[model samples]
Target chain A: MKIAMPDGSRKEMTVSVARIDEILKELNINPVEVVVAKNGKIVPEEETASCADELKIVRIVHGG
Target chain B: MLNDLEKKRYSRQIRLFGEDGQAKLKKAGAFIAGAGGLGSVISIYMAAAGFGKIRIVDCDSVELSNLNRQVLHWSDDVGRSKARSAKDTLEGINPEIEVEALEETISKENIDQLLSGCSLIMDAMDNFSTRYILNKAALQKKIPLFHGAICGYQGQATTVIPGKTACLRCTFPRAPPVTTFPALGSTCGVIGSIQVTEAVKYVLGFGGLLENRLMLWDGLSCSMDEVACMRNPGCQDCSALIGDANYKQEMSK
Candidate 1:
């Protein structure tokens, strides 16, 4: 699945992670700093994901 | 009621959207929640654009460190309150607009009072905790909150319309580890200017807003991208308005 990485880049990867939280964890991303979208739909971190689903991680840090 | 002086002063922009659009701007009241980097730029543009009433609040006194991005306060005004300096600068830029400068900290108790009479809220705050407060107040008051934030070379902005889009809490449920993040005046300029632009369009009743879209500006790469966001049904802050279809339909037009 195509995943839009946070550094303004895109990468296609095969992953076995089932839950969105684990996918973020595997990427070493802090969940607080990003909103993960699965197949163009925003999902909570607890939602399940599969290797066939495309994902995008949008980082939302820095408040000022 | 564009008098001779006011008409001449705003003539350039008046040529674009006509006097009625300018009048809509003149009738709008905007509240800015900070007086630092983003606030400096946001208030300046809002005042210059003829946004009728502007109230800015900041509890801190200016220091030498703030000179880097707080354009409203100069070296001579170091010891003075940021809110006062902001008022001085904004009034000086455009004497036609009313400017209220308050030296007060925003809290849950006073958030509603601070936003009273203001039709729009400009989120120039430096932290998410306060942004959350502004978000809740905006939802309760049913006003649009123009959210802009910056760090180093990256910045983000989104327009939160109460009952219509995903509120700030929906996107940023947890505050990031707050620390002294690096800042640049240019980044604040880009983001804050966008916030003012959003406020102008919102008040003038024209242009598509950043609703449900998080605009990410990456200065390092010089790219602007947006991610779609939706109103979280289970969001603690905005869950009350789960099905406000009428407001959404009218506002979308």
Candidate 2:
């Protein structure tokens, strides 16, 4: 599966899990702290993502 | 009816939206939640563009370090309250508009009172704790919230239309860990300008609203990208009001 990180890097990984949160965990990302989008649509933490899906992650902490 | 001075002041923009659109801008009231980096840009542009009334609140006093991005506060005004400094600067920019500055911390108890009479809210806050408070108030009041935040050379902005669009909580369910993040003044200008533009579009009833779209800007790369957003049915802040008819009616007000 391929995961697109927020820093604009794409990582190709082989994982056994189908859920988005599991995949994020495999990428060493904290699923609870970032928003995940699959194929341009935001998905819930429980939604499943496949290897063919395009993913985007956004972190919301910033000092205004 | 616009007076002679009002007509002349807004002539340039009147060409784009016409007199009625200009009137809408003149009749709107906006509440800004901060007077720091983003707040400085948002409020200044709103005032210069002839927003009829502006209410800005901030409890912090200006310091020497804030001068970089906080354009509204000057060196001589370092010891003054940011709210007072922002008000003075905005009034000097456009005396025709009304500027009300309050030096108070925004909490759940006083959010409603601070936002009273304001048609929309501007999220210029540096921290997420207060941003969440403003989001809850916006949901309850059914007022639109213009959200903007910045860190270093990266920034993001989104427009929240109560009951119609995904809210701040829906997008960011958990706040990122608090820390002292580096910020650049130009990044604030970029995000804050987009926010003010969204507010103007909302008030004038023209152009496409951000809705469920989040705009992310990377200054280092000079690129702007968007991520699609959707309302979370299980979101704690907005879930209860999702299907309620009373909430819909409140939104229309």
Candidate 3:
């Protein structure tokens, strides 16, 4: 499946996991201070563990 | 139907804006929330500019401390409800227009009813909770919201157009943790004038509204910046709207 990123890049990945952390780790990302948007919608923090989709990640914290 | 006196009274602005612009102003209905510092200036300008209908909402009564900034209220108006005072002052400026004074707090339950049928909503509120509620209502109703906030010598203004542009939440997912910030009366004047500018421009169909851009002014440094921004697809409010639409389509069972 093609996973979309916030920067509008597509990555080919085959993963059977629904959690955001799983996808992040698979993509070599640490899940701290990172916000995930799946298919252009914000995945609430509570649902991040259960929601499944082709994902786009947006990092929220750093420099203002 | 404007008369000769009305035309002459507003001749200067009319000459610059022309008859069509004057007509647009006369037809617009503006809902101003919070008749405090910012609302004071915003109400005056909108009234002076000849917006046909304006609703001023506020729950507080004018106090002695409000004299420094709230120019709309006189010493005689003290101890009177701010909304009523604002209405009185606005009408005094132009007796031809209609002004409604709603002396009540804009709670979550009543926001929609208060804002319904208005062309635009201007938020001059001091608290974040109320502003958030306004933002949600604006998005849900698809009304253009002009937001202005001030602290000390600094102020920020932005325009949010439902699904078309980034919202206040997109910029700050959560309200800033700080409450009880300092604010100068002049800062309110500066920011509130910009809010009025945006509202008039929107009403008159003038060139490019300040969508997706945060206009910041710092009286301390005398600097201004237009921070360009875009819609955050990840914004909960934006995303929820998208979800509900898709959900409705799929669940047509």
Per-model DockQ against the true two-chain complex: 0.62, 0.72, 0.04
TM-score of each: 0.94, 0.95, 0.75
What TM-score does each model's chain B reach against the true chain B?
0.96, 0.97, 0.92
Off by over 4 Å in 3: A1-64, B243-253
lDDT of 3 by residue, B47-132 (tens): 99899899989999999888877788999999999988998899899898999999889999999889866888988888666888
Model 1 in CAPRI terms: which quality? medium
What is candidate 1's lDDT per residue for B46-118, written digit by digit as tens?
A: 9999999999999999999889998988999999989888888999999999999999999999988888899
Model 1 regions more than 4 Å off: B243-253
Task: Please list all clashing residue pairs in model 1, or write none if there are none.
Answer: A64-B150
Backbone clashes in model 2, listed as residue pairs: none
For every candidate structure, what is the RMSD over all alpha carbons to the true structure, in angstroms? Answer: 2.1, 2.0, 9.0
Deviation in Å, model 2, residue A25 alpha carbon: 2.4
lDDT of 2 by residue, B90-201 (tens): 9999999999999999999999899999999999998888999999899888899999999899898999988888889998877887888898999999999999999999
Higher-scoring candidate on DockQ, 1 or 2? 2
Stronger candidate by lDDT (1 vs 3): 1
Residue-by-residue lDDT tens digits, candidate 2, A1-64: 6677878787876654488887777778887657888888778878988767777887664688
